[model samples]
Target: MQKVVIVEDFCIACYNCEVACVATHSRSEEPIKAYKRENLRGRSNALVEVNGPIAFSAMCRHCKHPWCLDTCISGAIQRLDNGIVYLDEERCVGCWGCVLGCPYGVAHPNLKGEEKHAFKCDLCIDRLEAGLKPACVEACPNKALIYDETMEETEGAYNR
Candidate 1:
């Protein structure tokens, strides 16, 4: 399964990943346009976690057995064959079941006002379909984020 690995040593806390996530997910899919609208209130699916000098970006883990998938009363959350966890926002009722069920606390409620919905990382499904890296991983200047098949392989590559 494809997974994003955070290389904590390389993280600089610049928040570029967060910016890229919002831009790509925005209505216009443009950074400038997304940031320009006062009502836009773009939210990044990936969050930059900080603890003093230590920081790293985090998103959905696409768990082997997702609690969010099981807890969703509306069946809005589903797991793809390839292991991506997807949310059908049209079906979401803002019950926050998934939000509370998520162990990593990545799932959140969308408060942008255009629509009340739940949001989390779908591993940038559109970009994955186009054979491109997730926006957040591509935006990292220090290469702190890595997408790969396994943690061992990802770590081995970074170690060298």
Candidate 2:
């Protein structure tokens, strides 16, 4: 399965990945409109962490055994045969079970809408199907985020 691999050393903490993610997932599919008009500043599936001089981008690992899928009370989380973990917002009940169960802490609570729900990186399934790389990976100027297709499934929370 293809996964987004982080190269911490190459990260510049520019937040390009986050902006790209919001734009890609936004209704308008435009960066300026997504942030200014849609007010989707914090809705990016990709997150950037900065500590001192160290920084790196993070998203869902799409684990072989996803805790989010296992703990979803409403059955909103499902793992596809291609290994992509998906969250069906319409079926979500705001239980936050997946949020609590996600070891990577990537699962987020979507409180911006009238009905809240849990969300995380979907690995840009739509973009992937269209033969395009994830927004975050494509937007990284330094190539810190790589679309790695040769990654083998591993055991534990970091599995992909």
lDDT of each: 0.84, 0.88
Candidate 2, which ten residues in sequence have the lowest lDDT sum?
Answer: 151-160
Off by over 4 Å in 2: 151-160
lDDT of 1 by residue, 1-160 (tens): 4767778888899999988988888888888788786344547888999999888887888888899999999989999998899998899988888889999889988876677889998899999899898999999999899886655532253552
Q: Native-vs-model 1 lDDT? A: 0.84
CA shift at 24, candidate 1, in angstroms?
Answer: 0.8
Candidate 1: Cα lDDT at 88 = 89
Pairs of residues at least 3 apart in sequence or in different chains that clash in candidate 1: none
Residue 24 miss distance in model 2 (angstroms): 0.4
Question: Model 1, which residues run further than 4 Å from truth?
Answer: 150-160
- Which 10 consecutive residues of model 1 have the lowest summed lDDT? 151-160
